[model samples]
Target chain A: MARILIIDDEEQLRDLLKQMLSRDGHEVVTAFDGVDGMRVFNQFNPELVITDIIMPNKDGIEVITELLCRNPNVAIIAISGGRRAITAEFNLESAEMLGVKGILSKPFTRDQLREAVQHALGL
Target chain B: MAIKTKNIIDFKSEAGRILLTSMGALLLLMVSAVFLSSYLETQLGSFKEVVFLGLAMVIALGAQWFLLKTIQSPQVLSPEERVHTTNEKLRHILNSITRQVESALGIKNTAVGGIENPADMLAATLIQCVAIMSEQVQSLLSALQMGSNESLEEARQSFIPLIDKTAETITQYLHVSQNIDNQLRERINETQQLLLNLRRELATVPQNQQQDTSQLFACIRQMGDVLETHLLIDNVVKKQLEVVTHDTNDSAFTLITLMRDLSDQAGNLVRYITETISKINAMENGVDESVGYIVRIGHFIQDIPEKIQRDIQAIQSASGVIDSLSYLVDSIKEISFQTDILAVNAAIQAAHAGDAGLGFKIVADEVRKLAVNSNKAAEMIEAGLDTARHTIHEGLKFKFLEEVMQQMNEAAQMMDSVKKLQEGHEDMRQYYKTLFTVINQSNMKLAQDISEILGSIQYQDIVRQRIERMQAAMQRRNELLQEFAIQLDVTSGNNMDDFATALNAVLNGYLEEESYHGNSLNSSDDGDQPPKFELF
Candidate 1:
């Protein structure tokens, strides 16, 4: 089992992801945004991180950059439900350009999440 | 040897000696009586009878004394010798009786080797010994009836050993039986304690099971609540998607219509500018022709005064041409004004299109500026026409052909301004074409964005399906837990096989559903594509 951190402004999606990952025997922690996520990341020292792109305080790109700076090998999976003129593809592509371990569009399935997590963790 | 001889009589030897002595004395008496009888028959017969009777009495007395002395010799044993002899006899009788009892009971070998259920064996041996004793007692009674003192004494001594042996056997049997009884009681007590412990352990099973069942029920309730929340979230997301989809579709349609209108307006404005350019070119040609005629008129007046009237008619014709050119300029000005109005309307429509029409709006502004420039050129041409018309009428009224020559210069300048206006109109036409292209590209991008938005809306349905699957699994789990709870309440038996089976079935069902849904979600169905994921 791996320790994972999830950062997202959507409470429902965060909780849902937590439940799904927890069922897979992983220890999961959640944060409301990138700011809280970073704080939790330091304290939790998780093996993997799953974050949403668009959020209130801080966004996924900033979080990915900061985490990569701290530990370049840290596994990160970026997820996004694009807003306004921005598409999820664009958001994910941007995160991918930053060298994230994995990317997923919003409303992803459990299997998809599991596969991404496996890929990120190199399992 | 002495004690044995003293205590026991030699009855056979003594009886033989006594019989021999009695017979010999009787024979002696008989002989005396016969001799005397024979002599007396001759001399004294009565004296012979008296001598025979006296000799027989003497023989009987001698026999009695000899038998008494022989029997009395053994009867004189010492008291100590008698007791020792009796004890020895008793011991011999006891040993013989014990051997008989052991042989009868088949216990001699068993006693040496040891036996199971010794108490039972001892009791059976004691019973058999008593039977032997009974036979001995019957023999003793027969011996007493026969008046045999020696046999009676031997029977009495044997009976004592038999009675004592039976009593000892019974006591040993009792001791063995008591030992067996105590062992049995200890085992019974141990068994009772074991049963009490088992009962106590069993008593706690129901309580512990009840607690576990309650915990299971609570978990089931929690799952139910989560399912309900998922359902609510699904509904809300779906409704929100519907609203967003509707609004996006309406906006897209409105934007498309507005773009179409703007494109048509741009096309119309380009066409108008083309026509206005042609009109301005034709009017410029007319102005140049009029200038040519006026110059010729100046030359005619210089050459001959007699041709002045002819030149006057020429000047009049040129003035009429100038009048028509003024009308053409006015028409061009009107077209320019119409183009300006169209540009302003296109700009308003572009503004309504928001961000997508920003380029279109810029082009519209350019078009409006061109229209304003066209109007300024039209006013310049009309003013030039007025100058030509005023110069022609002055030349005709004053009869001075020099003023008409100056009218030619002003007309040439007006022709240059008209040519410039025609060039400006040409530039406006190209700008309008570029604007149309910009608008077309913007509209295409907008349509694509709208399609993407429609595709993104499918995420809601996907989420709803996932939630529904979870709800189904939760419902099944709850049902199984309820059945387990009922089973617990119904029976106190620790039969958990049924509950375990049911629980496994529920878990398997949930896992199967999840796998099926996962596969379905990953599978492509027509235009329904799986979610995009990437490992970078």
Candidate 2:
């Protein structure tokens, strides 16, 4: 299994994702927000990153941009639960414009996560 | 007196008087000549008469000549008369020249238009100067006439001031002419300045127009650059969107396939769990039956020790009977000793009577043989009785019945433990059954959730398509705007129809897309309706 990173503001989601990916036999790292995520990303250097679009410090778009600048071929999957005015579609489309590997809306299932991850990693 | 006569002498009247006198003289001469001619004819003949007629003709000619001279010839008068006559002629000539000058200057003709140019103004000024000189000359002539009646010194005194006044008028005219020339020069300078200002204004107009034209062209070029940038951005966005759509579609398909497989697996697991539960129930029943059989077997074995004890008591009672039989065998042995003694006494009596009692001896011997046989039978019977009693006693000595009873109680306790273990197994089976049910329910819920997630994925794709359509419409709008900008001209009025048409097309496209999606531009609420996804 590929090394994966899960970044989200929600504690439960992060833990749940970490558990799921770990169960799937992937080495998983967790972060609370985009800022911490980037720090963790730099240190972990995971093969794939699953990041939430809207976050406290650095948003998913900025993270994607920075990561792409560092490594253009880095695998990225954007997820969003949609905030007040910004819908998940808008955020995901924005991520798509930045050339993300995959995107998932909020309330996605484990299977969907696995599918997106697999697809992103070209598995 | 000569002046008065000259004034009274009319030339026509003098000519008529001279003709009358000539005629009268001729008549008189003709009469005398007629008389002379008669006398000559009577005395000296017609020659003397012709001579007298000739004399009369000469006298008539002289009279006519004298009258013509008195009537036509200027009369010689005094010097004052000559001065007055010359003064009248000069005054008349001066008045005529002034009138001619006034007429030339249009002073006499009020109908003539005024001077229009500097030349005409100069001419008018000069004519005024001439008129002043003529007036001065007229005054000089008047002064000369007036002085004719006075002394020559008086005439000189009057004439000097009048000449000086005439010279002053000529000087004033010259000065006025010079001032008019100066004013004409100033007007020419003013006109030249006006022309220069007009030329400067005319020259500035084209430069301002050129600047404005250059600015307009720059604005057009800037607009073109803006349009080009917009087009470039549109193309890039279009390409990126295509890639996103393609990736999303593939992910969706893959997700759907995974869902199907998971659903099948879940169904199979539920089926397997149900089958396992059924098998466990059957096994539980079998276990219950085995427990019941063990309980019955335990009850049956529960009394084996007591039964063994009773059988051991019966064997002990049989051992007492063997003891009684041993006592009877001792009484028989005593009888055998007594019989042997009797046989020996009979045998001694039979020997004393030997020949005479051969029969008696034979009976005694036979009795002795019988006693011996009886003694041996008794010994054998006693020995058998003793052995039977000892064996019975030994068999009752060990506690075999207590041991069998202990083993039977232990078996009964083991049956109870088996029953409890079966009860625990039933509880464990129930717990496993509940766990399987929870697992099955969770699997179903998981399937439902996955289906919902798939729906959301489809929604994402739909939103993407809508956005793509919007991008396409915006691109078309930019293209139309560029076309409009290119066609825009300030000289000619704008072709608003093209703009309106293009805008309408864009709006119609939006409306069509919205309608196709079963949405309305006026509606803001989408409710909970799931978004439909199209692969394309």
Candidate 3:
């Protein structure tokens, strides 16, 4: 099982991810904002970080940069949900540049997340 | 590959004749083309006589006649004839489908007058369902927006519980945060008062020490010593204050972030509710389309039961003629699938039997195409009927409707809970803000007091220490004055006592009467000073 950190401003979404991912036997930790996320990330150094793109006190990109700076070997997963559909989301190419190991659009199913994680880990 | 060569009407043979006719036309065409080419060449100065071209054309025509009866067009249906004929049959198919639609859906459909195409009829019916459902979906969405207690009859029944669960979660978090706010405010208020008390304790000294010779001198000496030590007290106080202020600031930041998070949670709930309702709509629409497709399937099955019985009689009558016709035995059997199939097959074979079968073959092809279409229509009708029966049987069951209505009601209840929870969360946010403002104002006042005290303490220490030092050195010299100005008691030690006392009296009076440069910090030793809660 992979250890995962979920970062989002929405607590319910955090809860939702926790329920879904943990039921698959993955260990999950949650943070509600970018700063707390960085703190928890540094402390836990979880195998994977699943973070929402929009946040305060340093957003997803900033967090990714800081995390990778601390440990370049770290793997991260960034996600963006349509706060509005047809609007620009977290750019996939940009996330790749920031060392994101995977990206997902939000409200995704378990199979999609699992498949992406498995592929990224080469499992 | 029908092997029947019986006068299965020779339309193809007639087509062969038509090809012979076309071959005759091509010969004429070739001759004209050569003549025209030679004429053009002569006009362009390339030829004087066209005799060579005329002689060549006569030879080609003679050759074309033999080509005619030989290969010619094999007795197949011409592409143009096939299209013209199929268009006529397709119109019939369209009419049949429209009738089926009429029988099944029972909607007020126009004659589909301009719509001769089968695809258009099908599309029109499907569009009918789509348009109807679109209106219903739009109304459902509007009803949801209003959150009318009774409007979303089915959905409200299902979604309410889920919304309630979400609302409960939000309320729990809000209460927790509210508790934290209350705790923090109390602690900060206490800290502020303590700071004020500390300043007062450090400001004054005891009153009795003002008049006492030894104690006054000792107190002044201690003040001189503490002037340096007081700088350390200032530094420690300043640092402790910084730590408190920093802690409060960090907590405030956390509180703000948490509040925004709560807002975000509320927003997420709203969005999720919208998405869920939309999904239900899409699902419901899908079910409705399935209903339409089922109706199409019913149209397909309606023909199967009646046509099969009619075909049984045709087969019996055709069997007798089959042996005499010899080659048409297979063709007759082919038509066993429908009344038209055998006719079409007979027509095709008759045409191939030279000129004799030509007329029959044309009829046979038309009848065969019609039979094929009818078979398809039968299948489609059967499928539609079965679909209608199965869908109605499965979907209209009491349990299914009950379950759907139950789920919808639960969803509605959940939505209500979410609304209430949002309102409660908003209140929580306001309470935090009010508490936050109070704590913030107190911290500011505390900061101001500490700042003023700290700023004044530095300057006060500098000036107070300088004066106390002067007072300490003068008193020590006064002890020296008493010793050096003592009257000579060598002649009679007892005799000089009066003189020493009188001089001491004179000195005490002068010292007591002297005025200081400014108002004293105390008229007497400063009241009720703490011995231990003193400077440090």
lDDT of 1 by residue, B188-269 (tens): 3433433343333234233423343444333333433332332332233233233323333333344334333333333333
Reproduced native contacts, each prediction: 0.00, 0.00, 0.00
Q: After superposition, how far is residue B237 of candidate 1 from its true place, in Å?
A: 20
For model 3, how big is the iRMS in angstroms? 17.4
Q: On a 0 to 100 scale, what is the lDDT of residue B158 in model 3?
A: 36
What TM-score, to 2 decimals, does candidate 1 have? Answer: 0.22
Winner on lDDT between 1 and 2 is 1
lDDT of 1 by residue, A37-104 (tens): 99999899999999998776677777887787677699999999765334576567556645589999
What is candidate 2's lDDT per residue for B1-536, written digit by digit as tens? 22223334545576787677777667767766676667667575656656776676677667666765655533454556544544443333223322322332232122112112332343343334334433433443343334332332333343344334433443443344344334434433433433343233234233423343443334333433333333343343333334333443444444444434433433433344444456556656656766776777677677766777797889878977877887777787777677778777877887888787778878878877887887788788877777776666665554565565677687777767687656657544443533343344444445454555445345444544555565566556555654553444331212434455455567577658766875443332433343345553
If both were scored by lDDT, which would come out higher, candidate 2 or candidate 3? 2
Clashes of each: 0, 0, 56
lDDT for model 2, please: 0.57
Who wins the lDDT comparison?
Answer: 1
DockQ of each: 0.02, 0.02, 0.02
- The digit string of per-residue lDDT tens for model 3 on B1-536 reads 01122123345666777777787788789788979978888877555358778777788777776666454532344756544443433333223322322322221121111112232333233233323333433443354456542454443333333333433433443343333334334433433433332233223222332232333233223322222222222232233223323332333333233333323332333343444345435444544554555454455445544654555445434543433443343343444365675775587578678787787777787777777766666556556555655554554455446645765765565555555445445433333332233333323433443343333233223323322333333333334323322311122111322433443443343334322422222321432331111131
lDDT of each: 0.58, 0.57, 0.47
Residue runs of model 2 more than 4 Å from their true location after superposition: A1-123, B1-407, B478-496, B518-536
Question: Worst 10-residue stretch by lDDT in candidate 2 chain A?
Answer: A82-91
In candidate 1, chain A reaches a TM of 0.98
TM per candidate: 0.22, 0.28, 0.19
